[model samples]
Target: MGLGRLSALDPKEPVRRYQRERPGELLHLDIKRLARFEGVGHRITGNRRGASQGLGYDFLHVAIDDATRLVRPQDRRSHAMAGLVQPAPAAC
Candidate 1:
């Protein structure tokens, strides 16, 4: 059978030029702060609960490979009561 038009599937007509790229060629970085639901609460007996109380944030720095599309995330949080104030964009 003959090959059909690639444009029919993807209107963008994207190319696979970067498919064979190597790692570190492209990286993805972001912050994944902990939601309020994932926070810990205190007990009424003047004792701390299982985890920290209130909402907490964790900075999740991620890196990706342009070719393999592999992903790597890094946790940059000291306290569970902290939040990510500023977030940077991923690059390729």
Candidate 2:
């Protein structure tokens, strides 16, 4: 369908809107690794000689509400969440 026809149904509405009924109804969680070491790293200089062998990395833990887009970020030494606990929600 054309955009003109689509917009007519819900003017100024997003293409997709997640309906969150409650505080914990919908949430998003993710983990990402941010390189902690600085130097002529592996990718650019290549790992043929194990250039980044001793270098370590830090992990970024992130959470967000699908409804409000409120984000919480924390950095950790490791990415393993085996014993990690969920943080209490902040006051609205």
Candidate 3:
């Protein structure tokens, strides 16, 4: 049988989907830190003797969209959570 027109259905009605969408619509974020290791029989120290000894960690933040495949980078040292607040959609 052929499918009938959707005009009979309410315009505001919601539809369910079996498949998932990708890019643009959704965004993912990730964070990473830099580490320093000492040689054998040696231990790492927190004291900074010089610029080389001032080893520190660097945080990496990333964002990926599910609909557009777009990636955006944020700050570091912390996890940034999206979807906490809803924003207006951008122009396509």
Candidate No. with top lDDT: 2
lDDT of 1: 0.48
Q: Indicate whether candidate 1 or candidate 2 has the larger lDDT.
A: 2
Structural similarity to truth (TM-score) of each candidate: 0.39, 0.52, 0.38
- For model 3, the stretches where C-alpha displacement exceeds 4 angstroms are 1-25, 35-51, 77-92
Candidate 2 pairs with clashing backbones: none
Candidate 2 regions with alpha-carbon error over 4 angstroms: 1-14, 39-53, 78-85
Model 1 agreement with the true structure over 4-55: per-residue lDDT tens digits: 8765665565676645455454544455655555433454445564664565
Whole-model alpha-carbon lDDT for candidate 2: 0.61
Candidate 2 lDDT tens digits, 1-92: 55567556775756984567655456677888876665776677767575545566778877776656667676665434532225424422
Ordered by lDDT, highest first, the candidates read 2, 1, 3
Cα deviation of 68 in candidate 1 (Å)?
2.1
For candidate 2, the 10 contiguous residues with the lowest summed lDDT are: 83-92
